[model samples]
Target: MFTHAGTLQHKFCSVAQCGVLIGITIGYTTTTAMSMAAVKRSNCFHKYGHGAACHVPNNSFMVIFAIIQIFLSQVPNFHKLSPLSVIAAIMSFAYSFIGIGLSVAKIFGEGIGKTTLTGIPIGKDFTAMEKMWKILSALGDFAFSYSFCFVLIEIQDTLKSSPPENKQMKKATAIGISTSIVFYMMCGMLGYAAFGNEAPGNFLTGFGFYDPFWLVDLANICIVVHLLGAYQVLAQPIFGYVESWSKEKWPQNKLISKEFSLWGYDINMLRFVWRTSYVIVMTMIAMIFPFFNDFVGLLGACTFWPLSVYFPLEMYISQAKIRKYSFTWIWMQIVSLVCFIVSLVAAIGSTRGLIISVQLFKPFQSES
Candidate 1:
């Protein structure tokens, strides 16, 4: 982002980066807690009946997950996360495929649920305004799922030099995006086929698949593991920047300057305290407002236009020296304008959803 944007525009990049990074932390915290709860709920359903309440409040899970993340966040930075990333990727696939397989099973066994080209009718499960908000939220979810552009630069920095980064990133982007689209399409299509408009945001965690209770539990565990890895990947860059800047600003401060060894790992006092506090705050925020879909939608809407679309387009035009008011420049601006409007609507819808959820919410209280 800093490489090509105007000097004054660099701040926008930083804002976008920090906004999305903080969002990822909060969203992942909520998600992992929900996943842990889902595992327990699956077990309860298995032991009891499908009609059982199986209510699982996620506040305790969120606290436990925060404790784990406080330790994991102590890992140095993005450069040291290769093995963790690999594990995360594997778990990502594991849960995704498990979900896909379950959807297929439900479709074949129970037959397809009622579906339509245009989706739910006006007065069915949702009112007109509610449906409009949900549609917008769905758009935001799609945007959020593909909002990996911000991490490309960090991933590039971690690559070895042998295969040139630009080339590597090009190939990586192609493969990653292609695979992700296929996976998401299968999940969405099959899940909707199995459950129609009632399809859950997370089928494994939701009530969609409980017969194979053990598999459902396993998939939820996989989701928790994947989120753990993803949390660190999104966090380390911010950690590195903050710690480095603080060190430069306070070079002689003992807490920030000195490092102490714990077992085999060298731990810095400032890093320990700051990171632990950050995780605790994240957990608290998540428990207070554990609206996962709303969080994803708002964060996606916030970052999609500025970070993924506008910044990249501006950078490309600047780097390539495209003439002002030229054909390419005009089209890019047109695209950007369209995306900005989409993002605006998405943000509004997400805010509405969040407000509704908060109204019904009891802070740190169990809800099923």
Candidate 2:
């Protein structure tokens, strides 16, 4: 869409208006990093016991992680981070394989049962409505897992602008999506097979295989490393936007692009300040809200339809000049409308679920 509009800035200024969406992306990126840091710290608590000196408080560790992210965020441009990004991708695959391997081993040794096959708690006394809500919640989470369309344009922008760039991007996207689906299904099915109703949000957390403690430690380390790099990758766009805005507003301010040598690395003062502030703000939000999965579901519900479904079809319809009330255009419009309705309901359901889960809102407080 941005490419069709000449430039991303032009697209944002025109029909693809979404300044707030970019802000949300940046905020979500840092919150994700904070969640990863919190999980890593929790692993420490589990390994060493709560009171051990090595165990760090979650908020404190998040702050430390935020500081690390601030530096990572200052890496000038996206291309410079490609090496680390590749490593992060590998780490992701490594952890997924370890998780699947562990789960399969456990399932084979313990024998499969009803929960392993169905993944539904056999004796739960959940009402039909409650069961429906749980299914919807899971659907919301699954949607979140596949919600990367918003960033697809940005990723495409990274590719070399050659004649076949678009074709190359489509192929790359197909491969990445196919691989992710396979891995997700394998891990989800096998993990549930191993732990069933006992599986926690972080599957690795439930592992107590002391005989292979190093493998678990390695997996946790990979997660931390991957998140650190992932944070920088996501922060780059926010940094670009902020830097461009600052330069436009204060072209006379030499400090906006002033470079100072820091430990032999040249660092821009404005870039450092604004990116650091962004990370700090996100870190604070993460500390306050801390429900990682719920937050992801809520964010996904709010943005997925517009970013992933409605906009793309609308853009195509407009760009291709599809005749009004024609079959293709009408069918696309119908699909988009249905998606919009679904997204709205998901957003409301996710918000209500979050409030209830957190005990922040009680509609029947006086009834009982």
Candidate 3:
């Protein structure tokens, strides 16, 4: 959409403003995955009768994961990661289905478990302000889950323009969204049914059945593998931006070749260094905070709101040259304003939660 606007202005201007926002999202997504991998590792260890001494620190696992990511980041191009991405997608589906199945089995064994209707009480417990804040935080999470739109342009760019690429992209998007919604609903409803109010931040960890220890271990392993692949996918865009920036800044640099020979095949050195450094920085952040849920909530609130809601609407309005006083424009403006306000509230709530968590020095506890 922004590309078309260049013709109107008689000059080419890319959406460089989005570069920073996308970079932040990629960093958060990578770190969040690393933190979750650590949590999963800790849980798996505890499940296998590991004593307290066997409990590796989250930072330790994070560092190890970072090393793995650094190696994987060396893959020359995003297209090369397609095979790993396919495996990751299958693993994700397997884990989600396994979780749903396990929850259903548990429910069959033990009748309908207790559940909560509303997330927060209307007046009995939290103040009105607190309730509103919590609701907004939940909204932020929902927005984040649906915020793959940031990557849509990249995916669409891969398609040939000769065909009706836009139409094909729209169809693909609808199918993808529909499938995700169904899977999310199934997994969420069943998970809540099984664990009720005691559900852990990660539903997979909440599963405590030992009779199926092998299956549980497999699921945990899949989670770790999927996160590794996912981290690469999210970080690729940042790698691209850095590579492009470096080339633009130093066009005459002979070392900045498109490909470098590695094991009889061409590899991009710029891709390797930038992506590896990005992973390293993300690893450091994960080690510093190491709180998976808090980081996810905070990232969703602070980044996804602008990337997912505000930018797309603004871009569409600009590209279409919608009049300021038109009904469609006015309605979109109001919606964007509301999204911005809600995002602000969510961000404040997330910050407060992180502060309390830090002050309490809550010991990391993984489900056994």
Candidate 4:
């Protein structure tokens, strides 16, 4: 079935086909999972996990590009070239290697740690930093996944605007959530299996499915696509709210120009400005933070944690009309709080380690 799906994923057809499949998958997965979760009244509607999924199409690209960006941003002093852009591309290659290492460490290291943390004996020779990285990576994963959960819950709530008791909506929610969870687990497992020890510098390298050459190539393409997609998704709500607010406050300015639509909301504008901005931002990020592996910790702490752990609980407790501050609410809140704390600690640890590494290697900069 997936073979056929892959064959159908030819450029333009891929987007439409993927959307249909994703929608169908979300619809069914949400229904079943939510139904079961509702029966048990478990706080399964994690927010972060969903937020991560919001960038599903471009997650791969961001993961890959972010790693490259970390290194590329610093490589200018290493060598000078015409236009300076060539140096950026060179740095990107180095960044890819580092990202691979990080990914390897994350998947294998974290996978082994999780096993041992549960009382299984994997090994005892791991260094303090290695152990720390493993733990931090797992925390990053959870945090990353949590953001995706936020998106899921919000989507469900929006879909079920009136009381949200419809069977179809519930089913869709369950399916979406479950699908995301499964995809995450599989990616983690497969990546860990492949990289074992010589992983990329970050989670992106640990994706496990793609080799370095293909990964980079695909990532380059995805960078462009993702930026466009993200802008579209994020801008829509912004534009809607802005337009609405403007209409109410300044009736004279309520007349939105057709050019603005062409700039973004319109097909021509979307293809032009969004595409250009997407490339520029991605290029900048790639150049800035070339070491995606290092950034994973930061990204998880800054972006993922806020979206997943913080927002979801706030949404559930503060927004849910029927969900009073009962046992479920309290338990969910506690869990969310713990997850956030853990994410913060892991991020701090990773950052500290990186800082120390930089400090120790400061004198050896030219050698590197």
User: What are the models' TM-scores?
Assistant: 0.95, 0.80, 0.79, 0.46
What's the TM for model 1?
Answer: 0.95
Indicate which candidate wins on TM-score.
1
Q: What lDDT tens digits, residue by residue, belong to model 4 across residues 25-92? A: 22222222222222122121133332232212222333344343333322312112232333333443
- Identify the superior model by lDDT, candidate 1 or candidate 2: 1
**lDDT (10s digit) by residue, model 1, range 47-97:** 898988989888889888888888888877644756776787799899999
| Model 2 Cα shift for residue 228 (angstroms) | 1.0
Deviating ranges (above 4 Å) for candidate 1 = 77-79, 150-154, 262-265
Per-residue error (Å), model 3, residue 107: 1.9
lDDT of each: 0.85, 0.64, 0.63, 0.41
Cα lDDT, model 1, residue 335: 98
Clashes of 3: 0
In candidate 2, which residue ranges exceed 4 Å CA deviation?
A: 2-56, 116-125, 150-154, 206-211, 261-264, 360-368
109 in model 3: Cα distance from truth in Å? 1.9
10 residues in a row with least lDDT, candidate 4: 36-45
> What's the lDDT for residue 342 in model 4?
82
List, residue by residue over 79-123, the lDDT tens digit for candidate 3.
454466568669878878877888888889885567769753456
Output the worst ten-in-a-row residue range by lDDT, candidate 1: 149-158
Model 2 has how many clashing residue pairs? Answer: 0
